[model samples]
Target: MRLSDVWPVRGVELRHGVLELRPMTEPDLPTILDRLPDDLEMDPTLPRYAALDPGVGRAVALVQGYWRAMGGWSPQDWALPFVVRLAGEVVGAQVLEGPHDYGAERVVDSSSWLVQQRRGQGLGTLMRAAVLELAFGHLGAVAAISSAYLENAASLGVSRRLGYADTHTSVLEHNGRQLQHLRLERDAWHGSGRGRAVTVRGVGPALPWFGLDGERA
Candidate 1:
């Protein structure tokens, strides 16, 4: 798919019960913050650096600023972010970055948290897979990358179940303390056991977005 001609955005209601990746509005901010964990951990390996702070509100603003600065969305060149909706409510956020400025490549990161009452329902796995479909099928990313702190078993388990392999481990800082981190790359994603089950849709114009002028590192 070539991202240069057009881009797709709408509520992608999935059959796995209830879900949607819709355009985020100011109203969505309140619910998004409510779902964040009180002790949100900012895994250093991840791009947005801070988490587990009492400042989820400030973080949301940062996300808004980051995407808005990506220039104009001309079908192929833009960075898109989404609010994960379930049962008609926004629960978490997903980021699909591509049509990159630094190099010719595209990738996505699925970061989310459910309210205290909604934990352990296998929702994370489903949500991550859905966004991955959007990246590989809709956004034409050669690979998707997801990282987690070694301490967070729930998040790490979701990645492992989805076929992510450890690319490397590094040290990260949060709360004036160091945590172990793991990076999962694309080749490992394809080799994952569950790669085939997630169905994808509307992937045609995403190529130019991931296509760079030269080879990617």
Candidate 2:
């Protein structure tokens, strides 16, 4: 039997024009690692990303992180590690996180990273839009939230274009950096029509896994 037959989330998919966002699978790990930039730069202060050997060692950590998230998933709290593909080519990763009591709160948060070479191609905006669609449109999320380092204009810009508003700023202890937190309510998202063109599939069987009613799926 297919894995998705047992774990419906594995079958969930989102599409916007040429961009597609789907759950990251074990088989996809090698391709994702291969796409990693050879000269990846990281701040030495962040203990998590700072690896003595940033090549194979760091890649192993990332794959492990994905595995941990997948294995630890529950209705109370979960994360969808979406692999972003542009016209069938892996370009980046987008993650949507539902914290504890997600069913009661109906709030979700997201973060994404695009390949260095794929920067500035509007793919970032599309990737975020696609996931927000799955969150606010398909998953019954009432509000979608995100945060980005102050210096990261590209990420903030994507949030702005997608109708997110500045809510506050908080210090990121990992690097002692400040990031702007943004939020977008369902009404605002619907009015903005950002992800209107996006479509979600395989949500019916996944609804129960998300602590949501199966009827809407």
Which candidate leads the pack in lDDT?
2
Mind giving the per-residue lDDT tens digits that candidate 2 earns over 85-183? 987889988889898678789899987788888989899888889988888887889998888889889889999999999999999675698989999
Q: Provide TM-scores for the models.
A: 0.65, 0.90
Per-residue lDDT tens digits for candidate 1, residues 1-217, read 6533444343332323456665455566666656665656533333552454447544655455444624455434555556766787666665555544424455555565655666688777877777676565444466665666667788888877777656766554444433333444555655664546655433333334444322222
Off by over 4 Å in 1: 1-15, 42-79, 99-103, 173-217
Q: Which RMSD does model 2 reach against the true structure? A: 2.7
Clashing pairs in 2: none
Find the candidate with the highest TM-score and give its number. 2
- Which portions of model 2 show Cα errors greater than 4 Å? 37-51
User: Lowest-lDDT window of 10 residues in candidate 2?
Assistant: 41-50
> Distance (Å) between predicted and true CA of 74, model 2?
0.8
